[model samples]
Target chain A: MTDTLTCANLSKSYGGVVAVRDVGFTIAPGEAYGLLGPNGAGKTTTISMLVGLLKPDTGTVVVGGADLSADPMAAKAKIGYVPQEIALYPDLTGRENLRFFCRLFGLPRKAVRARVEEVLDLVGLADRADAKLDTYSGGMKRRINIGAALLHRPELLILDEPTVGVDPQSRKSILDGLERLVADGMALLYTSHYMEEVERVCDRIAIVDHGSIVAEGTRHELVALVGGADRIELTLDGDVDTALAKLRGLGGVTEAVRTAAGSVRLIAEGGRYLLPSVISTVDGIAAVTAVEVVEPDLEATFLHLTGNTLRD
Target chain B: MRPHPVLALVAANLRRHSRDRVGLFFIVVMPFVSIIFVGMALGGGAAAARLPVGVVAQESDPVAAAVLAELRAHPDLEIKTVGGEEELRAGVRGGALAAGVVIPPGSTRFELVMTQSSGSGMAARSAVDASVGRVAGVIEATRAATSAGASPAHAAELVRRAQAASADVEVVGSDTASATPRGFAYTAPANLLLFTFINSMAVAAALVESRRIGMLPRAFTAPVRRGAVLFGEALSRFLVAAAQAVLIMVVSSLLFGVSWGEPFGVAAVVGVFALVATGAAILMGSLVRSSAQPSAIGPPLGIVLGMLGGCLWPAEAAGPTLDTIGHLFPHAWGMDALLTLSRPGTGLGDVLLEVAVLGLMAAVLLSLSLVLFSRRTRTL
Candidate 1:
């Protein structure tokens, strides 16, 4: 199957300042790719070029097999973009805003309503869709902003910091919605400054700093490049002391520490691969309610590559 | 078939603007208020609507009394009786009267006191001259008869006969058959152009706000062509300005009895002026980076242009310099067209030069504005 998106050696400069340089990446169908960077790290500039908002100074962007520079309209039509800021009419209701966008996109009359309703439901904002955007909370507006991009059912969704100012609960809801989209076989190119969000949601991640892509790979592959191992957190509903003792002796676990009540943190070489053995080992000792396989801290991985923290 | 994107954008813009109460006030209310105020101030028509002129007589001679009575009875003269020449001069200077006339004891020639700065002063002086001329004719007839050795009673009878004969001659106004607009005719179209042009320019605030909030950039992201959005914005502004002009025309015609001659000519002028207004508005929208700048600057600049363009008064009334400057503006050309039509027998053919000039103005301004606005959008 063709990749959902491809960008090659893209670069952009404003006067003397180079905002992005030779930035390139690709996303496969049904995969989630994250463009990770700190502020002023060329994330937005790269996404702008990808979506045809800004023409790159050098190189090409192809969306869904259509070369952007050659056929921009067709490429643009196949991609959905949710910019960082709320690009919405504040005086208009959520439904009105959706209707306007759908109409502007030139959707057929028969399909507009159905598409709008489906996207509204996808964003979990069907209940308050009649309220004006100005009356909405920041999180609600962000959700509607995402809903607007989904109206045309584009093949690849490009989101630039979709959860910038959202509260935690709303952030989780947004992430959950996005994950469902990926599961439904839609490709996503997500850019964000939040390391945890990119680590949690992305299948492949690219770390960008100082106008260039410093590193690009899957979470485990990136961790391996920085010579870091994964951390596994196992939560027991019962008999936490016994599980902690057994967790320490697990083969893949180099070290195990009891971090909290009923929980043990294990540093393992292949945490996700070791989950089955870890689960079985803890079975007789205690009932393991949940297991979280965390790849080596992306923040540490980023800092290792750039000598600066992601937040910086 | 689907509506064009430009039409959709225009509809949305019009809807949004209509919902703005402050904008509606400027569009609907302010122009009408200015029309009524300026129309009433101009006394609204012909000789019967002329301004008040004060008269003071040092002598209660019958001829003087007759002159005063004749002045009071004249259609163009609204007479106010003062005590003497001093009071007459004071009334003219203090703006208590348009002009004042003093009849000295045994003198037929009167002292006419008037302010050169006042717009109504010329009308008052003319009325005074007509009234004093009647008194002079009567005195000449009586003195000629008495010097010819006629009886006093006979001289009085001859003077009465001469006065009767003098009233028989018809007094036609110098401007009666000419194309100059008078009274409310002058105020209506002038204020209409003033309000619509300036109001259209001031509405650029909405565009500035849209650009600032990223709505303009967002619009460009749609599948529609880029020029369509810019055209949509210009069309919306043109429609608003045209609507304002029409509203003022209808209200002034129906309520204030103001007349706009030659329907096709008037419509042509309005259409072209609205086009100019739209161009100016878009140009303003492109030039300003913030809403505050246009909101603060547009209306005042419009007022200065309106004043120079002869909205408050005729361009001829202002001196040669301002009149030349006034003709340079679209408002002055628009006023020229409407005023030409105000003549009794004028037609579309009479105002063609003004219409053609305005059309050229619209073309040039619209092109310049479109170019500047397109450049700004391209950089974004």
Candidate 2:
């Protein structure tokens, strides 16, 4: 099947300053593609171009089959964009806000009521849909903001930092809901500075910085680019020195040391898979009380690629 | 069965406004209060003091002399004698005199002239008519006696003896010429234009708020074109202005006895002026950076323009230079159109120039505002 979204050589500038430059990517149906970057790293600018809110100075965006620059209405109709801010009428009830977007998107009158209700339920705000948005918590308003985008069931959902200021529980709910949508074959272009969120939600990740994508791959492939090793920490009830020696002797283990806390910290390739072997290898020498496998993740990859932390 | 985007946008804005109690009170209720207060304070109250009137008598007959004497004696009228009927008419039209009266040679017939635009003019007409009725009673009694075969001198003598023998009686005649409504009628139209334009400017804050809340950017992301968004905003302001104008027209006519002259003419002026106000509102909304900026600046700006446009006072009374300057604002033209329609025989055709000028103002303001708005949204 054709990709749900395809954009190439997307570049935008303002007054001799480039906001986004030559960013390219595609999301096939059912894939969760993430544009991972720090703030001011051109994620929003790139999303602006993709959603047709901003015209790229030099690029082409095609949504489904329609070119964005040439056939903006058709291209835009296929995109459901959730902006970073809670962009809704505060005086309107959550349900009212949803219904308004339904009309704005020109949903069929006969289906709008049902579609709004479905979206309200999908965003987990069904019980409080009658409350005014100003009365809602930030997370609830964010959910409604998301719900508004879903009323028309666009083929591709473009979310820019969907959970920037959300409470932990609401953030979990949002991520879970998004995962379900991706599983149901809706393509998602998620952008955020939050490393863990991208790791948990994205099927393919692109690390963006300085108006360009420096790296793009699956989670394992990205981590492999930085040649990062997982650190495995083990606490022992007996024979700590001997257990450290055995861990060093293991094939995947690159280095082993005993922490000041008396636990053995081992750096290894495929540390999570190496956990079973380490536990067994240490068994004959000592009693293993606890084990934690700190796997290599996109945070390290981001830092290695951009030489800056995600928060920067 | 999808609703049109522009209608949906308008409905949403109006709905939001309806839910705002403070905004509703100001937009819907305040104009009536202003009309009543300003109307009473200016000319509609029964306790209002005496008004000046001009009189021109073309004959030296007893009837004309008696009517002139009675008018001069009336407590409510401060009468001034002018050279001719044309001078009297000019005094009333120029607002130097409240009303004018002309008595022809050898005839008991009297003509009353009043500018329809002034509430004081109406009051002066009523006072002059009451004073003329007293002399009309004596004339009738004298004619009755003469027709009964009494000589002219004896007829006069008999009427004088009858008046001295019994309590005096007064007869009133109803031969009054019509003009535009005065007093509360004048106040209603003036306040309608003033409040509608002011309210339209104030609601520019809503547009600024929409931008602040990211509604404009979100709207741009939709399948709808940018023109739809601009048109929706313009239409919303137009509906509000038109609705306010209609409400004032209806309430003033029903409760205050305001006669809006020439329905089609009144409608034409109100409609075009609403467009002018809409254009101004959109332009203000586009130019202001913050919601508070419009609210803070709109009323004062509206009042200053209203003062210049003759809504607060007659521009003609403000002298030639100010009158010319007043026409620079659309308010003056709207007021002029409504005032012109107040004349008894004036029709829509008479005020076409005023309406056309207002329509052109609306076009230019709307075009400039839409271009700025489109650029602003595009950059968002």
lDDT on C-alpha atoms for all candidate structures: 0.81, 0.84
- Candidate 2's residue-wise lDDT over B1-380, tens digit each? 87788887898889887887867887788988888876764456323346778888844677788888888888777888899988998888777788888888788788889865455775676778788887887888989999999999999999889878766655466556433334566678888899899889888888888877788789888899888988898899999899989999988888886777899999999999999999889899889999888778988988888888877765544667887888999988988898778666789998999999999999999899888877776643
Clashing pairs in 2: B119-B183
Chain A TM-scores in order: 0.77, 0.79
* Candidate 1, number of clashes: 0
Q: Under CAPRI classification, how is model 2 graded?
A: acceptable
Q: For model 1, state the Cα shift of residue B35 in Å.
A: 1.8
Top candidate by TM-score: 1
Q: Assess every candidate by TM-score.
A: 0.77, 0.75
In model 2, what lDDT does residue B194 have?
92
The segments of candidate 1 whose C-alpha lies over 4 angstroms from its true place after superposition are A229-296, A309-312, B44-54, B57-99, B103-183, B313-317, B378-380
Candidate 1 chain A: 10-residue stretch with minimal lDDT: A303-312
